[model samples]
Target: MTQERVAMIRERLQQALPVQHLDVEDESHLHVGHAGAKDGGGHFRVLVVSDAFDGLAPLKRHRLVYDAMGDAMRRDTIHALSIRALTPAEYERETA
Candidate 1:
């Protein structure tokens, strides 16, 4: 189920943003037996590098991702998401 949710989120972003680099990690295991996981919500982290976010602010980037998740958030499919939204250049620079 966690993998499915991650796949859905990744697919949505790829289709909509065409990211240069995308990484989705299911951190749910780290939260096992925790409150969030117990409620059917999982902890995940995402790293997305795409020109689509070139000029967006950090908050806007998060908003875009949350928007894409839509009902997933409401349904407790995703409880917490840590996102690093970046352009290709930003991602490369950070990794350097």
Candidate 2:
């Protein structure tokens, strides 16, 4: 289920954004009995790099990602999303 959710999320984000680098990590197990986990939704952390976010404000970037996740967020497949939206240059600098 964790792998499936990650795949689904990766696909959705890729389809919605021109991602240069994307990583999705399932953190549900780390949550254990947290209220959201008990409700059956998954927790995920996403690091996405895309030119699509080039000029967007941080909140707008998050909104774009949330919009991309559309059904996953709305349907409870994703309980919480920790996202780091970055442009390719930003990613390169961070890694450097």
Candidate 3:
């Protein structure tokens, strides 16, 4: 189920943006027994590198990521998301 959710998230983001690199990690186990976890939603962290975020501010970039997550969020499939949205250049600089 976790793998399926991750694949769905990746597919959604890829469809919405020109994704250069993407990683989605499930962290639900770390949050077990937490209040939000009671609802069956999972915690996830995502690192998304795309040219689509080139000139966007942090909030805007996050919004893009959230928008890409559309239904998953609305339906409670994703309870919490830690997002790292960056342009390809930014990714390279940060990783260097």
The candidate that wins on lDDT is: 3
Candidate 1 colliding pairs: none
lDDT agreement of model 1 with the native: 0.86
How many clashes in each structure? 0, 0, 0
TM-score of each: 0.89, 0.96, 0.97
- lDDT tens digits, residue span 66-90, model 3: 9999989977699999999999999
For residue 7, model 1's alpha carbon misses the true position, in angstroms, by 1.1
Candidate 1 per-residue lDDT over residues 1-93, each given as its tens digit: 877988988987787776799899999889888987888898889998888788889999888877877887887888888999998889989
Query: Which model is ahead, 1 or 3, in terms of lDDT?
Result: 3
Residue 77 miss distance in model 1 (angstroms): 1.1
Worst 10 residues of 1 by lDDT: 65-74
